[model samples]
Target: MSKPALLVTAADLAPQALALLQDFEIVYAGKTPQPADIVALARRHDPVAIIVRYGQVNAEAMDAAPSLKVISKHGSGIDTIDKVAAAARGIEVKAAVGANAAAVAEQAMALLLACAKSVVKLNDRMHHGHWDKATHKSVELAGRTVGVVGLGAIGRRFARIAAAMEMRVIGFDPFAKDLPDHVRPVDLATLWSEADVISLHCPLTEENRNLLNAQTLSQCKRGVIVVNTGRGGLIDEAALLAALESGQVGMAGLDAFAQEPTPANHPFFGHPQLVLSPHIGGVTSDAYVNMGIAAANNVLAVVGKAVAA
Candidate 1:
């Protein structure tokens, strides 16, 4: 039998994943391709499987490639892929979740601390010779109440760290049947009302999109710090801006944005209390390799008619 053929989107294919391709041929694309473009490309390979990242896999893409059997995501968050489309075509969709839990959790902590210490403000003041240390205010993490949304792998990891810091941890997850001993389960409203800090770790879904809108935010304690290492659409950007303006929310640490590379003139670009990272919550070197390898291995396993963790 000939080697199983594969199509991969713009990502460095790891050697471990490459090794699995020993029995398969591989095709590569630099970035997401349009519907017609993907069809034309698929004609050349007639690949058995296609792997993509945050790219649409609409009916057109599948209809163009009759031989396609599986669609695999390079990381967690299936919000980008059209799972319904894949399923209708009898194509399997698999994601590499928990592959970078540690990386995301660690970055969340880094942002939380930065917000608590007002690190960016202090650093900028010192750079400009303001010597405003006396006016600078910072809070300790130990005695704060941290509300964690979505008690999944990353959320649990973050909660663990918060507990270690002596912070009272509250969690909310509709799917959670049982939670860790350290985290106290609470309703969404209670979490918003009681938490001194709130961290979002949920996925982006229709029911959850803009979950932290104005109404929900109004229930938060004044000066509540917010962090989101999850999805950008989970919070309402416009509402968040208003809250920041009125001091309803003291600070925000964002690793992901509604739009990537956020437009140059965006309001968040120069916001003092806002600490923004380039959606790199899961971009650690270790995470890169692990997720890459797992995605690749999953492709191989799914191609062979099996499931991979």
Candidate 2:
């Protein structure tokens, strides 16, 4: 008998994960897949499962894959998949939770350090043959307070690292449990008013979209540094740009944005105080294999197949 089809919405999958799926025929969606591409592929392949990596999955695509029993995410965030639509069709939606936690947390730390010390700016000056030692001053992290939003695996790990640096770590996440002893849990208001740096690690939901818009930014301490390794929509880019321009925000380090491959003309560019990365917080070599394995397991378990021993 022919094996069932499993569709992956990326150009490639880790060989480690592919090795475990020997029983299934796998199909790959090309890089930069769009919604229509996913729908078309679903209709053409009629896959039994879909591993979402880079596209939106909605009811239309679900209807196209009648045999699809599960939709698995390569990473923790599932905001790209329409959960309501999947539930209506009895399709299970699963995420590889914490699979990339260490990678992303380390990235958040790197960004925070880069911002606080003006590492990027100083490097540019050095390359330009202008010594800035006489005029440059970097913020001290040891005595600062960092407020973390969303105390999940990534958030908690970042908080722990911040505490090690002797920085006060306050966080907010009503759903988080077993938080570290050093992480003080506080309300959003208190975090905004008291934090020297605000870091976002929350998921993107309708209620929390633009959570760091003008109003919230205003509530924050002036010259507060901002770090986001979370969803891009969590911070309003326009507001953040304005704050950065007005000196209300001292610096920003971002690994995510409202748009993927943020356009060349985007307003956030040309600001020395702002540091940007291509949303690669969880793209480490180890995370690739870990997330791939975990995503495969999520797909297998939901399809009533036992994972290999």
lDDT of 2 by residue, 1-309 (tens): 677888899999999999878887899988889999999999998998999889889999999999999999999999999999999999999999999999999999999999999999999889999998899899999989999999998999999999999999999998988888999999999999999999999999999999999999999999999999999999999999999988889899999999987999988888888999999999999999999999998888877453233
Best by lDDT, which number?
2
lDDT of each: 0.84, 0.92
- Cα lDDT over the full model 2: 0.92
Q: Name the best candidate (by TM-score).
A: 2
- Model 1, range 188-259, lDDT digits (tens) per residue? 999999999999999889999999889999999998999999999998999999999889999999998887
Lowest lDDT block of 10, candidate 1:
300-309
Error of 1 at 12 (Å): 1.6
lDDT, candidate 2, residue 301?
Answer: 89
Error of 1 at 169 (Å): 0.5
